[model samples]
Target: MSQSDADAIDEGVLADARAEASVAPVPKGSLWRDRNFLTMWSGQALSQFGAQITELAIPVLAVLLLDATEFEVGVLTAANVAAFLLIGLPAGAWIDRMRKRHVMIWADGVRALALATLPLLWWAGALQMWHVFAVALVMGIATVFFDVSYQSIIPSLVRPGQIAEANGKLQSTYELANIAGPGLGGWLIGVLTAPFAILATVGTYLASLVALMLTRDHEERRAPEDHAPILREIGEGLRFVFTERLLRRIVGYTATGNFFNTLATTLLPIFLLRDLGLSPASMGLIFSLGAIGGFVGAIATPHIVRRIGEARAIPISAIAMSVGAALLPVAALVPALAFPLLVAQSFTASFTVLLYNITQVTFRQRITPPRLLGRMNASVRFVVWGVMPLAALLSGALGTWFGVVPTLWIAAGGELLACLFVVLAPFWTMRELPDAHSASR
Candidate 1:
């Protein structure tokens, strides 16, 4: 077909997708009884657990086996998230043009293969820090595709009403993995060679790949259209996000929260380990205990949204997040209160943050056309997660120059300001999400 004909067909598909986004579908059956959704859920559960194991294992491997310096460790961390900045835009356009399930399965398989190579190299006594970095970078790239497709695929799995419930369950599994994965990683490393420990992670990805392959989703095929130039496609996604008032507000809310929340990741360890003189065991316990908040928040979100509406729930959650951020800095002031304070902050922060996550995810899914969903999600992630590496680097500079406590206070203050963005913006006052898909276009 000619380019004009293709564009016209795409525009028709876009119109249909927007209409679908505006209406709630009647429930066919509970997502629980839907075999396909269960299969998809099982895959996600496995993938999340595997990701957690690798997240811890990679850093531990570098520190223990490769004897990587602190600077190198920082670099490894940055490399893991660098793909969001580098590939986030184009990946979205690519995913939207392809089948989401295929993208997810291939991404998983590629990541598994990349990780499996580590053990072979290790067994040969030729493992190096650069190899680890390269693997991490590869994994990050695969993850970008997986994550974008993952969110975009959800509406296909369940009813619109069920999106919040489904998302809550997914978040619960994710948090459960985060709480348990590190401890599991530590055990595997202690019992087996660091290289061999990776086998479990590799196995999980394989399992996830298998599960996804087995699941049958009857996704409505989009019309065949001429592909736009990659950069223009990316710009289209960015323009959608920025032009829509609701999307613009959400983007601002998330970007601000992530940027200022950097101190929690960057400085919390130092404050707990050096300033407070806590054992690693105690610190781990604190985090694990606090992760319960995430589980609680996820479980509680559907109810919160139902009772108060998503608009109210989000601002309330933001307030909780701001308070959590503020408390981290103050925890150092009272040595006697330090441990308890950190634990409280951890729990409250996780719970509230997840509340924000579940609500926003459901809202976005409801308001965005399926065709633009991947691009919209990618645009949000690029702006939000893009700041993370820079924030990490900035956190180090500030912490070293101004001391940990002061830097944390600055982070906390920034978080409070972040809360205000959501509170004052359209997200807070809008009781219901209108058809933002059409509005954006």
Candidate 2:
């Protein structure tokens, strides 16, 4: 569809999120009082913490145990996120026709099962690089469905105005998981080995599954007769995201950031472990300390948004994050200061990311109609996340050809350039979001 057609559709679809503010029942008291929201929150907290384990342990497994090369490590990492590019759009359309809660449950179960195989393979002395790649691929696919469903589920559990708060609460816990999970995961790797650490992740997912099974969702499941052609539905989703000027700019900035960020991270294990000689335990500590910034950012976002306004918050945070990213290459320059520099970089970068994500995600959730929530979230993820696999592969190739340090320098420069997308836009001139009612009119 053309931009003009998308603009026309935008008008009809924008209706205070279909009069959500006017018609939806606002719950009394705090979101803390809501059982469904709590259930979802607790379940996700466990899963998030568990995920941190795999994030650290998997790469450590490949590099330390499997003796994988730079390019091979990149391929393994790429496998984990490649599914976002593969099935992201169709997953959204398929999910819209089903219960989101059920999707979450199934996705969790699938991940748990996939992760369980790694330890079993290791115990049997049959673990291979292909097995690791296959598991990563499967888990990545499941994560795509779970994440889209997860974000879409929030608006149903809370009021429109509460979305920022809901997201803030969720992000806070996720950051908390980041702080603790890596440390524990690293320790687990030290004690239990990488494959065994994955067992802990499996248990956490099972716990999450139980919680999700009990949580009530308020989704307005579409009847089979109400569904459009899958391709048409996917197009509508893509149009909805791109036709909106602000969303488009945000997508551009995020995609660019993800591309460069993944490029650097795909080779970080080689640089930190091999070049600088940091142990997995030390690496985990640095990650945990750095994540403290994210926790603070999540808590501080509402106050910052209130003071500066959400529109201005986006670009401001984007600029700040790019500044933080500059430290990545700087760490390469001073080997003695590398550990502290990396920690500082992670802290500053993570903080601003939480600031940027919470504000933008809340804006997307509030403006989008409930029916389009899943597809909208998926479409956004498709664009933003799709670059990661390519970045991983490119990082591997660049690391092989140009060396890890030089590639990191390139990654840092590219991240800084990404900020221009948001900064050059009209966000600086605006203070508040356009109300959905006002936007449609």
Best by lDDT: 2
Query: Which portions of model 2 show Cα errors greater than 4 Å?
Result: 1-43, 153-172, 213-221, 306-309, 365-371, 433-441
TM-scores, all models, native as reference: 0.76, 0.85
Candidate 2 lDDT over 1-441, as tens digits, reads 000101111221233334554555454447888787888888888999999989999898888888888888889879998998999779867887888889999999999999999989988999999999999999999988887677567666776755555665776687578799889888998898888888878999999999998887677889889888999888888998988888788889988988988898898888878878888888888889987887687689999999999999999988888777778778878989999999998888778887887777767767777778657866877888888899999998998899888998898899889889999988898898775555332
The true-versus-predicted C-alpha distance at residue 160 of model 2, in Å, is: 10
Write the residue-wise lDDT of candidate 1 on 44-124 in tens digits.
888887886776567656756786654455566667778988887777677767888999999999999999988889889
